[model samples]
Target: MSSSHDTHAAHDAATSHGAHAEKKSMRLMLHVWRQRDPSAEGKFVTYKLDDVSPDMSFLEMLDVLNERLIAGGDEAIAFDHDCREGICGACSLTINGQPHGFESETTTCQIHMRRFEDGQTIYIEPFRANAFPVVKDLVVDRGAFDRIIAAGGFITARAGSAPDANALPVPQVAADAAMDAAACIGCGACVAACKNASAMLFVSAKVSHLALLPQGQAERNSRVLAMVEQMDKEGFGNCTNESECEAACPKGISVSNIARLNREYLRALASSD
Candidate 1:
């Protein structure tokens, strides 16, 4: 591997900003979670990085460390990331026991080095849950989420062309609620932060987004049932009405969605009976 600069980048997708502004060298002690694979026992391995740019994103700092590791003939830390943008939610990491660190409404990719003290120790770990088993260092298998979505996260209604914007008249309140739920990126931070490892927040967001829209009404009854069933089958614990999931959520998806999910589920059950 080569340096993370000028073409031979270690992780070209990862990004940082304002490298020249407020140039301060940050020395950090990183106790990062390390696991070879799913069957391997995971542990926190300490690595010290000096002269790090305060402008670098958390992943970019890791990239710099990885470059150094490669140059020194050591194994590079493995973590999941794509699009460096927070929208993908691919760069999920538990920072200092919080889902995406102490920052509010921020993803791991959006966390910059400036958020921490110059010589502080930071703990980085993969999001933990029974369904999201560790794949490697700081990377977990979040395929259970994909499975849940696959079970019934889509509407089967097909259209030949784009409908007019005014064709469907949706109430502003419903539209707003659907938009709020649609913000979920499936990061699984809520699961990691929850003591019960509940995925209700994630599931509820997925369910409520569709249920509030008219286009989603066709399969609305079955969607909730199938999704909740798949969620249970994936070993995610039930929600105990704890708001930790919402508090940990990077998107700030409301717990109200969970209430909506329960209502949807009950309605589905009654309709089935």
Candidate 2:
């Protein structure tokens, strides 16, 4: 082939690849729920966003959508987020019928646009649970979790002289178990995804972490009783062994912790006067 013809063909191929890349980065329709207040009715509002980068995090994509809305003289979507690092558990959403979509062991804040295809229709809903009523678009009142914790989930150690780290030598097995339970981030995903909307998994993790530790031994019995009582008071349902909480938990906390919580409650009751 002539050198001029070869160069022309290469240019054509590069142009075609650029066009394909642009097509691949095209827009999508995001149907997000909007509510003015807890008592107000919510409706799905559709917004179209074009040329969204696949590398954008889910929250960043929403930011782009909000910017467009403001530019178009429309109200922006409201959502909760903090520590976008997926640690605060504030970013909660029910995306496409999954707590955090098809991604295993991830929070809503950690989801990115790469999981979705161009021109896909995405449905975003607030995490739903009786205890977590909608406060606004994609925002729910998760104060129920806080109340449960306040009842007696944590130890009551008074601050004083710093104790030696090795003063209480915990067994390796017990320490490891405690650490596993302590991994819970207090995200209400478990409650949102459960058929019964039970908070047993969250409560169990707290109960198990404290029950297994020596420093927590003093109030172990009372802690379990008080927390479980507060859980019921918060309008959370009883666990029927459906195990939905474990499947939906972002932390993958086991259902066995619920079993442990039940056992601890029973033991506490039996030993009580």
Candidate 3:
């Protein structure tokens, strides 16, 4: 409705505002773990960042650090990230001793630099667990999770192609529970948070999600048994009921799934005997 002159002026104003916003920055200190590889001795190396943007996500801040290191002819810090929007669960840094930092119900990639204070020293480390050994700084081998899932996290039923939602006839409660357990992203924050580095939370979610559904009934008992057995064989420790796993989970996956896993394992054991 306006003249072309007014439109050009508005565009100029918006561009100026965006340029101004980008100028805002923060200073921070980072004590990041540095290890050449699994066999190398790891240590925390301090780096001072003078121009961090509050608008940057946590991973973006790391990207900036890597750029600076590359410019200085130094090896960049190694880390994991995929689908920076948080669905893939690949950003696995233990920031300030908290998995995914201070953010609640959010992944590390979803955490903004604004959550930190200016001039604060942040400690970053890879998720620590026997099953999740560090491959490099802030990157651990999560293949143990893949192995557990492969053990029996699925149904062997011959039910071909996906069925229509209405044909399933699943109860609302059961469907809701299944969907809730299915939300797990397999981030291993549970193992990192547990004192014993236990993977019960992760294993349980996989078990409960399928077991609660009718399609999972045929292999439910064996599924739990196989997954739990693999979880132990991977050198992961036992859950002592400390519940730190639930607290660190970005999805807030309930520990009640762990209890269901215990029951399923018991049932499987009794029947086998």
Reference-based lDDT, each prediction: 0.87, 0.83, 0.88
Clashing pairs in 3: none
Off by over 4 Å in 3: 1-23
Summarize candidate 1's per-residue lDDT along 1-273 as a digit string, tens digits.
Answer: 122343423233233323433456899999999888889988999999988876578899999999999999988999888967678889788999998888877888877776788899999988889999998888889999999999986687666698888988899999999999999999999899899999999999999999999999999999999999999999998899989989888899999999999999999999953
Error of 3 at 168 (Å): 2.2
1-273: candidate 3 lDDT, tens digit per residue: 112334553454456556654445789999999999999999999999999867577898999999999999999999999988778988899999999887777899887776788889999999998889999988999999999999985676667888786987889999999999999999999999999999999999999999999889988888888999999999999999989999999988999999999999999888953
Better candidate number, 2 or 3, judged by TM-score = 3
Identify the leading candidate in terms of TM-score.
1
| Candidates ranked, most accurate by lDDT first | 3, 1, 2
lDDT of 2: 0.83
Number of backbone-clashing residue pairs for each candidate, in the order shown: 0, 0, 0
Candidate 2 clashing pairs, residues 3+ apart or interchain: none
* Full-model lDDT, candidate 3: 0.88
Instruction: Please give the lDDT score at residue 15 for candidate 3.
Output: 68
